[model samples]
Target: MRVRKLTFAALAVAAGLSLTACNGDDGTAQSDGSSSSSSSTSGGGSGSGGSEQGGGKDDSAGKSSAGSGSDAQAKAAKCRTDDLDITAKDSTIDGDDEGTVAVEFKNGGGRDCLLSGYAGVDLKTSEGDLSAERSGQESSPMVLKDGESVFFGVTYPLNESGGSGVKVSSLVITPPNETKSFSVEWPGAATLPVTDGSGSSVKVGPMGSAGQGGAS
Candidate 1:
């Protein structure tokens, strides 16, 4: 009877130890699960920070694009006739009877502006006004700051022989994209005759930075 009681006590002790071991294993599993959950939460926070960084980059790019649009909107205005100091002179080729009336435009304003296209020219004669034709050169926009200058030409044949021509006395000049007109006397008005019987021979060229035929 004493041996049987001792055997039964030993079995009970072993069962208790086994149950404790199982509880310990379950606790270890719970700890590992908690660690995994914490790691997952930490990874989620890191991903949120990355999203915020990307958002910041997007905002910066948006501001840069807006600034570029503003810069594009700040282009210069068209040059007005009141902003120019204009002069005209005769440009006779050495041997050819073909001649040019070089019209120089100086920007005398305080701000920068744009100059483009042909100068509206009308040759005033005794019979009637002869309007000059365009020379078919491409007119490009050019910026003219204060004190800058550009030139255009009024080309016509001298018609030294008594032929189909008109004797020009004065010129009515109009700058491009403007309504105001200014007058300058035709250089050598008494001697030179512009052959414009069809009224299409006298031609006006495009504006240039260098001189006549220097349009760009």
Candidate 2:
């Protein structure tokens, strides 16, 4: 009887130990699984955050690139013709006995531009009937291009040149596509003496009267 009782106690203790070991193993396995799940979730969150930041950066860069491209296009579309300028070599010339003055036009823009058709200069006077005159030569509509210059003379016959000042009034430049007019002025003739000579006697006032009428 005592042997049987001892055997029963040993069996009970063995069963209890086995149950304890199984409980410990179950706890350890559950902890390991929970740690692995937390690590995976954290890694996934970080990766997602990185992707979102990268995407935002890409969008910003794309917008900047698009803006730069638009600016470049606008610049390219702008016409490069503002550098064209024109001036009169001699803004004023002495009028003939008929009160006719000739002016020589020059190009000062130093850049290329188009000059088609003829340009006219109007002499505005209060004393007499002054008109705008154009040189009759029909020039090939030209692209003045850069650094190219041409001269045309207009004759304004003044009725009386004592107290009246003449203005260039307007200058017309005809291009292939359109016509442009610029305002210009001529020197006033305060004291002009009457002379009787052919084309060789006409000269600009404020200076001597010995040169030719159409001396370029």
Which candidate number would show the highest TM-score if scored against the true structure? 1
Return the TM-score for each candidate structure.
Answer: 0.70, 0.37
Model 2 residue 16 distance off true place after TM-score fit, in angstroms: 0.5
lDDT of 1 by residue, 1-216 (tens): 999999999999999999999999999999999999999977877788999999999999999898888676868899899999888887755785677778888899888899878889887887688788999988898898888888888887666767555567898999999999989889833434553465567788888722744322
**Lowest summed-lDDT stretch of 10 residues in model 2?**
201-210
Which residue runs of candidate 2 sit more than 4 Å off their true CA positions?
A: 50-70, 76-216
Residue range with the least summed lDDT across 10 consecutive positions in model 1: 188-197
TM-score of 2: 0.37
lDDT of 2: 0.46
Go through the candidates in order and give each one's C-alpha lDDT.
Answer: 0.80, 0.46
Residues 73-120 of candidate 2 have per-residue lDDT tens digits of 522121122444444434354443444333333334564455555443
Question: Candidate 1 at residue 10, lDDT?
Answer: 100
